[model samples]
Target: MTTKNVNLVSHPLVQHKLSLMREKDRSIKGFRELLNEIGMLLCYEVTRDLPLEMVDIETPLQPMKAPQIAGKKLTFAPILRAGVGFLDGMLALVPSARVAHIGLYRDPETLQAVEYYFKAPHDLSDRTVVMMDPMLATGNSACAAASLLKARGARDIRFVCLLAAPEGIAHFQKEHSDVPIWTAAVDERLNDHGYILPGLGDAGDRMFGTK
Candidate 1:
């Protein structure tokens, strides 16, 4: 489903993997592997529109002009802990991309995002930033992360996730309408405690076996 600034990746592979991840009984290994696979696929979709420039090159048999991604290397900024799960796969596709880490945890009672750590390339203004977080449930963390990036000079930012809740999307867009979102699915709604209904549990816990 496409919305104003959201792109739902309806690819069959992505959907299938996401379904497996959503299964409550899924093994930790399976969940982590699936998240990695989906991360690679989503990375593909998110970077589809990146600009390219042609350069003269010599092939094995003949000379040619080859197109390569234009501009500075991209920065993959993953919200810490759970967001780290998407990193390996995304980096597998764009190995040279820089990495930025943002650490924010939701306050248990208030459900507001509280930041404890943040680090990124100094040239954020010169590179495209893709922020990865598997679940966009409350949008509190996502919005706060974006604000942090913008304050650090990042102008081009995109958000990628496995699943999102309607409330989260609304809250995110309302605050950072300029940043587009790409996700595998948009779940029905968030539960009372800010978890997405039918979401694949706590992403950090599931991925890290912390629960």
Candidate 2:
């Protein structure tokens, strides 16, 4: 069920959609739509263990007690700008969840992740933080982003991605063993350029057609 704390969303729909997205020449509309659909499904998988509490509610026929998510609400921290691709669909499922943005870019020559922007909810420490990034390749930015959130007082955190590479997961777990990861697939390896082998390509470019 858990591999190095990376939970793969293996539902049939997620599997099928991810396969479609991996095609060579998908349109922007198709890619974006499929990503959203997968995002929504991933939301279901990641938050499966959210704490719940009994609450009294009135049904159409009678009053009854129901269970609702309890204690801390959620905060979605998207590692931009590709992470933004998963934002809308995730929010669609958890409409009340707040969003945090962290902008980072990997340097071409050095492959170092550089932070360009950061904005997060003030009550991060009290909420469960779900960090979103479509691909986990080098794990440089993902680790840095997790550290940033911790420094800013975030205690409970998790990560979600569309596909993850073994090297990336190892690097990320080396830095953060407590924060669990969720992905649609655990890819085989990272290419020489720090890209996931057989990856759907640069997710941002695929979504926006910059490629």
Candidate 3:
């Protein structure tokens, strides 16, 4: 089955930054910053289809007409706690957007996603929601989170991330055919350890300086 849509942006800035993020030796600060920056770039691609409506407005010297987003409330949902790293950058670009958080972890044995936290806007059904998670390693967590969001009545869902492995993307496609993915890079595969091959390591640990 096809997932709604998965778009891997190939812009130069995104590609260069993603390469840096994939290096094992990159500094934690650098990695975190790149995640945020890439998130913004991905945000641009993800929001491209947002509907706009023409509006007449006053400019510094005269009245001018312009278009602004029309008829769609936007909600930015970040999968915690690593996803929080991308949240700030997205918010900077979309200051008026509402925020949601999903906290889940995969069981080492069962490999099933277990949700421990989830909170979103009350009017999710009317909003266009963008879900952010930096790494799509196994796709279990992201897919599960997306399912939860759909259950909460969110429509026009978009999933954005920094890196994705083919395995992860395939898994997401199977599970979330209704939602399209927007990401910077799709890596080769997942390693035996559940890490994406050549991945920068645990995103949360690197972002927060945790061991």
Candidate 4:
């Protein structure tokens, strides 16, 4: 079942940590840490409704039944550099999850996505895919990346990001309404160059100290 498409994770801890991440002068190390920490928290919300199955297990003494996540394998596909920042934190929550990488960058004037790299494990139909990226500004790259995955046979896919813009969300839903969006905040709007205003700047630069 397709859960509600867009999710705004407004938990207090998420909000406070996101605030820390938005500071322009914040150190790269500090921003990276907060990104991962918040990624874990968002992971909690994204996986909340995953199916569970009961199984018999032996405890310290007798055998008893316990619930475990249904055998729905998970794949975390991060969109290149910035998205990688959220992976470690998410792995802490689901170490067994496979990782996929999709490399796409926006064209300067046209703002369209150009793919550079794509990789995934086999049996895409059996696994749930979570696309990770720190910022969803114009939604070009995210939508393009999700389309690539769908072309490869992935049926269950969702998106997770730290920040989003309304224009981005609308464009994303228009293209891929079946995929849900989980984000920490939806800022005011995207600036002329397609950057989210009041956003934490270029996520790749902030995460990697490139700018």
Candidate 5:
């Protein structure tokens, strides 16, 4: 397997928010709020390398100059259901950014990912796409999502998740060596049930307070 650069976000704010989300007794509202906070924090790290162009603009009292993103073609693809939780928070920081949704439900018998839905905006060739999903376990969904983005001509693609398993990271690296992964934390392993061991349970369930 290729060595993938899986960034485990270690910022204090992110760490604090993740800690709160891990509390089993936390309310649904609290879980949702923490997820949003984590999303914004993760976004800060992900956008660090975005292309910036120097531009001149007038300040409140005088003329000023600064650098800003070169274009507005950024697209955030949230693997459906659980990924939606991270979407809201990311959009809070980038309200004008376009969004796409990909749904992948795993088949129990075959243990493979099955795509049920997909939608994205036009002209992705020059756009910077950031894919969001709360958990990266087995890496099937993420790999599929990244492959979809590549098929759409998205050369600059990145994946963001709240948590990741070592095996999943390895799988992602082997499948998409060029794509980079930014995650808040990397757990130890995946349990027999395909869930990340010591993970925060099912991120979708915790985010929505469902079983």
Candidate 6:
């Protein structure tokens, strides 16, 4: 489903893997592998509209014009720990894409995002940037990460997550309406502690076997 700035992937493969991830008894290795597979699928969805240009090429039989992605190589910016889970799969699809790391953690009491580290290519303004995370619950961390990217001159930015809550999507649109969001599913709502209910739990914990 496509909304104003949110795109729900909803592919059968994505939905099936997501349901497996949501199971409380799923093994850490299984969860990690599934997340990686979904990341690759999401990467395919988000880059579907990237511009393409025809180039001269020679097939074994004859010469021909072939299509290749146009413009500068894109960048994948993952939001710290959980976001890293999506990195390998995305990189596997776009091996030449650049990578930027944005480290932000949510404050438990206030449910706000706090940044601790950031690093990116200096030519961010020249390339498309995709910010990634496993979950978008409160939306604070995603917004903060986008703001940081903007400050660094990232003009074309996109956000991708595994799951999202309605409140989180609303909050994100209110803050960064221009940045599009892509996810597998938008669940019911946030709980008292600012977590997506029926979410796959803390993604970082499940992926890393942490408490």
What's the residue-level lDDT of 146 in candidate 6? Answer: 96
What's the lDDT for residue 9 in model 2?
A: 86
Model 2: how far is 144 from its true place, Å? 0.7
Q: Local distance difference test, per candidate?
A: 0.95, 0.92, 0.87, 0.92, 0.86, 0.95
Candidate 4, residue 60: the lDDT equals 95
lDDT of 2 by residue, 1-211 (tens): 2366879788999999999999988889999999988889999998999999999999999999999999877999999888988989999999999999999999989988999999998989999999999998999989999999998999999999999998889889989989999999988888899999899999988898888
- Residue-level lDDT of model 6, residues 12-123, one tens digit each, is 9999999999999999999999999999999999999999999999999999999999999999999998999999999999999999999999999999999999999999
Per-residue lDDT for 114-170 in model 4, tens only? 999999987778988999999999999999999999998999998999999989998
Model 5, residue 28: displacement in angstroms?
Answer: 1.5
Better of 3 and 6 by lDDT: 6
Clashing pairs in 3: 3-177, 4-177
TM-score of each candidate?
Answer: 0.98, 0.96, 0.93, 0.97, 0.94, 0.98
lDDT of 3 by residue, 1-211 (tens): 2434778799999999988887878888898899889888888899998999999999999998899999756899999889998887888899999998899987888777899999999889999999988889899999999999999998778899888888888898888888888888777778887888777788888888885
- The worst-scoring run of ten residues by lDDT in candidate 1 lies at 1-10
Clashes of 6: 0
User: lDDT tens string, model 1, 33-94?
Assistant: 99999999999999999999999999999999999999999999999889989999999999
Which of the two candidates, 2 or 3, achieves a greater TM-score against the reference?
Answer: 2
Give candidate 6 regions above 4 Å deviation. none
Query: Which residue runs of candidate 5 sit more than 4 Å off their true CA positions?
Result: 1-4
Put down candidate 5 lDDT per residue, 2-73, tens digits, no spaces: 444777789988988887888778888888888887888888899888889999999999988888899875
Question: What shift in Å separates residue 31 of candidate 1 from its native position after superposition?
Answer: 0.6
Error of 2 at 5 (Å): 0.8
